[model samples]
Target: MSRIKKLLMVVVALLLLAVGGLYLYKDAAVRSGVIASGDQVLGADSTTLDSASLDLFGGGLALRGLKLKNPEGYQQPHFFQLGGIDVDVSLGSLLARRIVVPSIALDGVELLVESVIDLDGPRLNLLTIRDQLRSSRVKNAEENSASSGQRFVIESLTVSDLKVMGLMTIPGGGSWPIDLDVPTFEIRDIGKKQKGVLLAEVVGIILVAMIDKAIDMIESDGSDKLKIAGDIRRGLKFFNRGLKESGLDPKLGKKLLDDAIQKGLGDLLKKKKKDR
Candidate 1:
């Protein structure tokens, strides 16, 4: 072969090897990003994932064994755990200021809500995490603005096979468990109004929505779980106050609680009338 042709062949081989290396390392890099983003929002070193796979050319990502630990003092293994997550990204928008995710599907999600009384006072894991996330939102927003970090736009997000469990610590250290199976729900056009939003904001929105649904489920259970329902109502009021303090609109949260209470009252009045 000619010298120039040999040199050209060597260059191509080197380029191919470099691309191959990038492909091999891409998954780890994406995994680290996910962990970092989650930790930032939660303000704890509790975000973990068993594995991540990223399609270099296709912009598809699959994450397995994603779990978020409960804050300190909680007995449950994890506050939130997911069997898997699949995300479809817009490859072209990756280079732009706004990263666009066309769809995200989360499967086999389990949320553990625990209520306990300690030296500090009564506390709920969900409320604790909500407070942390709310505080982080303001801080994250400032940091993103200062650093010109890329924002995200999620066109659709869906959660399936969600199981919510409640653990209430009773007298003498025993705990009662309440298991609920939640129907699948979807949120569309996240960050559409402002074009894009910080990752923390997106997580905060989803968490709050899920908590709201869980509260509704607890209230509507007409079983002998009225105490649990009362605790949830009080927690909802506290959460609404936090929302107001954080400069967020609390109308939706308050309205939901109000409607639930009204419904319960109306049902009770009807029951009494029928009994008479």
Candidate 2:
């Protein structure tokens, strides 16, 4: 019996050692992935991976002060630097094949839009940074689908605080500054197939907004009116199609959107009509 007990102890010790080694290995890998991912997303090299820790046993992970260098000529470097990003992801939630992002928080995100036209365009491109995030999520989803464990999914995304600065060129001279604060943004069920369809609708809305903003920028009374109407029509078409596919009342949705657009642009259109 003593011999058997000793043998069992040896086996248990070996098992414990194996488990400990695996935990450490996985912890390191997770940290490396986080650092690499942060670098890739910013299109910049990682300047720091100050602290990265993982607790696989308890399904907790943390990454802190992951910094990235700004791309050359990008305002982020000159004006404001991305201080760092903090992320905490759940391991069990990740393996459960559900939208499982516990939290992603970014701090000190900076952008400098130069008054110069060439720099301004690239600065404006920064607005599309969400696209890169979406791509990363998609890649994660694909990996999760492949794994037997539940994939990390994102059901809702919360933006705690966001600041945007837009530098616009005036027709004859100086720059006009537009500052925006996005206090909260929630995106739902983004990890599912329906995400594509939902994203299409969102992109459509953004396109409409861009067109309207462009028309406003033109600053010609008649031009604004014409362009606003065109944008309204385009947005309605997209809304109509989405509603139809969703098996909702397409006509009602289209009519409602049209009414809202018309009401909003009423004065502009009426003045144009009178001038004509």
Candidate 3:
């Protein structure tokens, strides 16, 4: 081999090594940044993750043992808890102090019960966040111009094995676990404006999604678990069948869910009547 050719090869290899090292460094930084962003976007006490690791090859991060504490005045310890989360981001956007995720997913999610006796009701932790998202401003010139402005745009999100388990907070109430398979939830246009957006707004979209799934859990199992709705209907049907084949009756496992579902329907009917 010629001497000059060997020198060029060495330089190219070094450049590749440097780029790979930079990616590794960025991975660590992004993990820490995501945790900090979550804490600030959610409440200080609301977001907690046991561990986070980035996948350079996948261009994303995997977060494990993630938990979201309940809002104030709730007896439950956590409003939402998950085994793991996977997020794929756009590298350019991430470097620019923004989060542009092409894909994100939650694995093994759990939503706890409400504070009061409303077994099938939504948790205040999620409800409060959902309401906040509704009221949040999409763009703020002053906030956007800040030195450390951050925005998130998620093009796709997938939630897997989302379960709702009632803690039996009320006396004489049995346990109730209503499961939903990727309950439908969509929040759009928060990052479209992109110039001026806060972490709180981004986090609120996530929290509201959690709330929307929890509400679906409450609504899906009403006297007719047979009629599960959304893109999840087929998945739910297959899951129920598999549960029975595994020797467990998802519906009859506890009478609590049935009773709570009935109560939910009754309340809805009463409110409708009163409105008339």
- Report the C-alpha lDDT of model 2 over 179-245, residue by residue, as the tens digit: 5443444454444453322222322222223323332333333224434434333332332234345
Ranking by TM-score: 1, 3, 2
Q: How many residue pairs clash in all the candidates, one count each?
A: 0, 5, 0
Name the better of 1 and 2 by lDDT. 1
Of the pair 2 and 3, which is ahead by TM-score?
A: 3
TM-score of each: 0.73, 0.48, 0.57
Question: Against the true structure, whose TM-score is highest?
Answer: 1
lDDT of each: 0.71, 0.43, 0.57
lDDT string, candidate 1, 46-79, tens digits = 8899999987578788999999889888778688
With a 3 Å backbone cut-off (N, CA, C), the pairs that clash in candidate 1 are none
- Residue 194, candidate 1: Cα error in Å is 2.6
lDDT (C-alpha) at residue 99 in model 3: 65
lDDT computed for candidate 3: 0.57
Instruction: Supply the TM-score for candidate 1.
Output: 0.73
List runs of model 3 lying over 4 Å from the truth. 1-28, 97-99, 117-125, 132-148, 167-190, 193-199, 220-276
